[model samples]
Target: MTPSAPPPFSTLIRTASQQQHTEAESSTFMGDLLGGRLGVEAYARYTEQLWFVYRALEEGARALVDDPVAGPFIRPELMRTGALARDLAHLRGEGWRDTAVPLPATSAYADRVTQCARSWPAGYVAHHYTRYLGDLSGGQIIRDRAERTWGFTRRGDGVRFYVFEEIPNPAAFKRSYRELLDGVRVDEVERRRVVEECGRAFALNTAVFRELGEEFPLSA
Candidate 1:
């Protein structure tokens, strides 16, 4: 009998990192934040942390615009820096940038995105896939929760980060993105490295959550 074909790259990535992904989601901070135990202040602080990360990711994408391996994934619609800034401004007032600071874990996460985007295209894709796809998928639930819980206007100034004005069909876009991952040329070793980097991305995200949990401990 013939051997089975290898799994698709997207499936490989999901299967390889499933446990870590769950851990990141189930972290104390995420648990509190998602369960509505935390207030809008906590959510705003989380957005501030995201600003540092997306800034690095988008700036790095600017440098990689010409890369043969990375260029195809450089989607203008996926860029979140501007939306994040607007969200922060609405949440924190005009001087949000002047006062916002990255938590230590956030700095490290941003640094890793910068490093990979500059050096390893596949690794950069690992982070890009982790974040933007999550934003498209699970992030929709987050947007709904924030809106209902905090009374933010629907798809208005406050929750602009979750609104994708460019992409009419997020599900189709995600499928096309996964197909691109499957088509990208990479050897066995590089594929393994990319999968591993995806795990690291989740870990870094969990660290940020852990720090947030510490800062905003749950009440009795």
Candidate 2:
């Protein structure tokens, strides 16, 4: 069964907080390493140049800015994949790539997330990736979009963020999600906190998207 959606407010904060955490997760591993957000070599490319790969990654990261459904369920990688694909269609369609949005300097949180993902002891990276894949495989719209658009199939030249093998059907994977949540019993207060955080996550994303939309605009 799906984890009971926490209360409205707790979910809000959790979702919002989680969004930042997710972006930080990507940046921690992908950003500084790639040229995108002051990281290393990029995993993918954009604008037919290696430099554009950073932009493509950011474009991919920015997709979760306003997603409400992100926090309640525990698979962010999956969430990002779906959102990234649609944004690609939008960002690529018009000339939004050239738009200027301030890329904030790295923060403490981002730094930590990177450390966690990078120093992921043993199977952490693989575990994290599995969680993300679980979210994407659900017959949900986000996964569907990513499966079609967000290119993660190739290797070598880019597309390093995904784990293409070892996982089974998304539906089967997701069936266990509810059980995962059910095991983590929280009180009314903690539950409220989670819900609130989720909402915050959505609000933050909304603001981010609203601003970007204004600068970029979906279409005419």
> After superposing candidate 2, which stretches have Cα over 4 Å from the reference?
1-164
Q: Could you tell me how far off, in angstroms, the CA of residue 68 lies in candidate 1 after the best superposition?
A: 1.7
Per-residue CA lDDT of model 1 for 134-216, tens digit only, reads: 99988898888889877889997778999999989999999999998898788878999999999999999999998888899
1-220, model 2: which lDDT tens digit per residue? 8998654432343344565455533433222223233211121222112122223323333443333332233343343343333344343444534552232221222232233334421112222222343234421332233334444333211232233333346556545554444433455565454445334333433343333334333231
TM-score of each: 0.97, 0.37
